[model samples]
Target: MISTTDIIISICYIAFIVALGFWAGLSGKKDGAAAGEYFLAGKSLKWPMIGMALFATNISCLHLVSLAQSGFDTGLLAGNFEWMAAFTLILLALFFIPFYIRSGVATLPDFLERRYNRACRDWLAVVSVVSAVVIHIAFSFLAGGIVLETLFGINMFTSIIAIALVTGAYTIVGGLRAVVVTEAVQTIVLLTGAVIITVLSWWKVGGWQPVMQVLQDGGQLDKLSMLHSSGDPSGLPWYAVFLGYPVIGIWYWCADQTIVQRVLGAKDENHARTGALFCGFIKVLPVFIFILPGLLAYVLYKQGHLDLEVLRQADGQLHTKGIYSVMITKLVPPGLVGVLVAALLSGLMSQISGALNSIATLVSYDLYKRNRPEATDQQLVKTGRIAAVLALLLSIGLLPLLNRYESLFNGINDVISHIAPPITCVFLLGVFWKKASSQAAQYTLWIGSALGAGVYLLGKLYPINIPPLMVAFYLFVVCVVLQVMLSFAFPMQHTAESNRLYWESPLAPLRVKGWPGLANYKVLSTVLLLMMAVLYWVFR
Candidate 1:
């Protein structure tokens, strides 16, 4: 059950978030403003805000709970999800940022139309909108409900509604500026809380040496091993770690709007690149803060220092059974519990607001006005706010359904893994492959979606015992390969037409200005390669 202190702290945090929305929402009354100001914060974000926004948006309740659970169950293998993210983030800063900014678009879908055609743009927009509704927003509500139940002693349905209403309140009012600014504050809270919990866990365990002893006794000492262990069930096989994780990470950091919007909001290209690199550097620390608690929880369990039986009820099941962060509450004192709960809420609010805002941007610019160019800016903004509210309702309704999944993290991972391949494929082709046509783009989207969904359903139905990660990895590879084959087999005579229709405007693409140092691509690639080598050496 949640203590009174935790509820007080949570309520205060919500109030602070509402205040931020008030500050940002005041700007909504400005007349004759460009969409840039509303959707992208007038492209005026600085490096610091960018970093926090990225961190806050990316580290949601999933990390607080599911990641901790993973560490508790599987030990160190979960760290790969964090440390490997650094490389992909750097890759995004280098290879993708320039193109995204140079396109001068309000949303990723707008870029798709500029690169492919209206059909391609519409296809991506539809997929993205649906995914936001069903997967991203819905899962976040589910995660928030879990947080509430664990910390507030409330039913999941009531908690879901409460969380959604709170988050959506600020999001609808404040828009992008509200999301980013609040994210900045929340990021600090999240980091401080996580670090505090880790430190306390160490001290309570009688320092590192005793902690190690406890972990070793519990058969969890090797949890820090980065490489797959032959004896381990959850470990990613060696091949999958290198190829699979990278692609998935790239798909997330580079193409996913929730992340890219942070970079896109940067005041300039340099800030965008700098902000991304900074976040990339910070990505390496999750192992210590998020995953280690699980190992520590296992240790506490082994020593009988913590009572799991008491932690459960008549069912012989733990409260918040699959939530990893809940372990910390049982181990920590009241004041510290308030801080960590605030941090968890911080992460949750950031993701919720970001998704709500991004979906609005897409709806307003890509779908709402695409066929109705006569709509005024005020009208579009009104529609955008409505979309935000509707998105929250969808999330609120889906939260309970999500709680039935085996692992909250696994449920989120499955959706992203399945959706990413096709989206990544078409976006990559649209940008770099001069020969890629609207027809080819459409075909690839269908083929990739089918291939990815088919593999997922097959693995589930057949009980193949293969990792879902493996299935998703192979599915994407096949789609990309077959897309290439099919494109060549039915190559059309639209080279000049494709170039005319799809090529980014020369001035727009070349708008980037700076005394170029090491190309971001070279710097990012080199750094990631070195980091991978070091990680492999350690893991090996």
Candidate 2:
């Protein structure tokens, strides 16, 4: 049970976050409330802040709780998502950052307009906004509500509302500046809480060898491996990971509005590039701290170190939803349990705030300002605030429906697998192949979206045996074929601006000069790539 001290600590931490947000908002008034100031934090973010904000925004309690659930159910296998993200972030740093920075666009849709046409921009803006709502905000709310309910014994929807209102109150007023400042602090707290749980669990389980022995004794030792071959029952084989991950990873890491908006706020291209690479390094932690706890829970239970009776369900299966909270209550001592609660709330609030700010940007820039090109800064700011409020309300309403998924982590990726292919294809070809036409991209996004939805509906009606990763790969293949053929048929009519966007050769982006010493993006990217390879090799 949570003690009185725990509740007080939790309340105090939340109040501090809200106050910090209010301070960030009030501080920004010095810049006089320009649209750029509100939407992109005046484009003044440095590398460290941008990196932490990016990581914090991408992660939610969904990651802490559901990832632990995945670790318990599977093993190190679920780390594929976390690990594969490094490659995409590297892509963002080396190739995508220059275009984003040089073009000086507020939203990705604005980039689409400059690269393709207004039709492309308009379509992408709608899709990006919907995606920010569904993928980023709604799922964060769902996972957060589950965590809050587990810890406080409060009604799930009630806790969600209370948290959302608090988070939104500051986010609507403060914009990206408040979001990122709060996120940087939240990231530190989140990492510390995760470290506490992991260290405690690790000590309780008697370290790696015992955990291995427990799994080996149970005859499920395959749980220890990070990579699997084609015949592995996990369905996500090595080849599928390589082929399928890039499809969704490109969309999530490189092109998604919510995730990429932090980079958009960078003080310069160097900051944007290094910030993304910095995030790549941080991605290495989730597999250890977040997912490993669940594996530890499994190992500890097998060794009779943990009692998981509360996780038992009426249908004779484990109720994995509350597993992380169970660990907090069981293993963590009283005063510190508040730290864990605060950390969970940190993830929930940071993720929602980041997405809310991105929604506001997309609305103000892509939806509202474009239509009213003559709109004042105040008008655009007001429009964005309204959009953020509406977006939060819509996401709250989606919680009950999204709560039905058995595996929140898997369910999220399954939805992304269907939604991401066309956008990924468009961005990839538009940036790499100068021959890619505006008409072709517009048509590909339109047709490919319908095709993916149709496939999803068909899967529901029929027994489709393919894995979600493989499904995404196949959809990407079809979309690529359609875009390639259409591009050939329609031939691009690139202006001087669009011509600067694509490179002359594969090595072109690498030839550009970066910051001096080890901080150079090329240097950092190389080091990160080597580090990831070593990690996978050791875990393999």
Candidate 3:
């Protein structure tokens, strides 16, 4: 049970977050209350805020709960999800951000229209909005609801409503500025709380050696290994990690609106790339702060300090869900419990608000303004606010349905793997392949969506048993082949404007001198790459 002190602390944390959000929103109003200020923070976000907001948005309640559960169930392999993001984030900073900024598009769909056609833009906007509501927002609500239900004994429905109201309150009022400002604060709270849990859990397990010794004694040493065999059913296989994970990572890190929107709101190219690099560095923390704590939880359970009965099935096997909650309830002290709960709630709110803001941007700019091109700045901002509220309502309505899934992490990954391949194809080809006609882009989207739906439905109806990761890889290959064929058959005439949008366009001289050495982007990119390599080496 939560003590009086813990309850007070948690309530205070929530109130402070809401108040901060409102303050940020009101500050944004001072800047003109225009669509640019509201939707993209007037393109004035610096590297620090951009980095923190990106990290906070990505590390949602799903990462806290589901990723921890993954560590508990499948071991160190879960760390790959956090660490491998380094590569994709670097790609975003070095390659994608320049083009996006040069194109001067507000949303990713807007970029598609500038590169291809309005038809391509419209299709992508529709898909993006739907995915944001159904997958991103809904999953956030579900994860937050699960945490509240397990810890505070709050019912899922009530938890979802409470979280939605708190998150949407700030997002609908303040827009991107409020989301970024609040996320920057939440990032600090999340890291501090996670660090506390990690340190305390490690101390409880009598340190690293003892934890390793317990796993070794239990004949579970493979749990410490980062790479697993293809035949290893308990952990992620190497094949999936190599061929499939990047597909999902590209869509998430480079192409997704919720993430890219942060970079889009950057003050300039240097800030955008710098912020992405900073976020990449921050990404390394999850393996230690989040996953390791879960491993520590498993160790504590083995040491008989934690009750495993509630986390066990009738077959005497461990069930991974609710492991994080169990760890907190059994191990953390009262006031500190409030801190960790605040951290978890921070993750939840960050993701929901980011999604809400991105959805508003997508609908208001990409869809509504397309029909009403002469709409005033105030009118566009109003449309975005209305769209945000509607999206929140739809997301809350979908929360109960999320209970049907056994594992929140797996459900999220499966949905992304199923739907992401086509979108990834479109973005990759649209940016790189000059010959990729608008017609080819359209065909690829339609065909890829149809193929993905068929594969997902067929897998569900029958016992296909293929890993969703591998399925994602296969789908990507097919889309690539189709795009190449269609583009060659019906190529579009390229112009100077279209050529400028590509990577090698005349946005030169590309090199900018940094403080006493090489270019800033190159320096940061090299550091991020080296860090990623060292992490994989150490963990592997």
TM-score of each: 0.91, 0.98, 0.96
Q: How far is candidate 2 from the true structure (C-alpha RMSD, Å)?
A: 1.0
Candidate 1 residue pairs in backbone clash: 76-223
lDDT digits (tens) for residues 327-429 of candidate 2: 9998999999999999999999999999899989998898898889999999998999999999988988777777778899888988899999999999999
Lowest-scoring 10 consecutive residues by lDDT in candidate 2? 25-34
- Which residue pairs overlap in candidate 2's backbone? none
lDDT of each: 0.73, 0.91, 0.85
Kindly list the per-residue Cα lDDT of model 3 for residues 292-369, writing each as its tens digit: 888888888888888968767899977677888888888898889999999999999999999999999998899999
TM-score of 1: 0.91
> Lowest summed lDDT over 10 consecutive residues: which window, candidate 1?
501-510
Q: What is the C-alpha RMSD of each candidate to the true structure, in Å?
A: 3.4, 1.0, 2.0
Compute the lDDT for candidate 2: 0.91
TM-score, ranked from best to worst:
2, 3, 1
Residue lDDT tens for model 1, 401-471:
66767677777777777778777776666555656656677788877877777766775677566555665
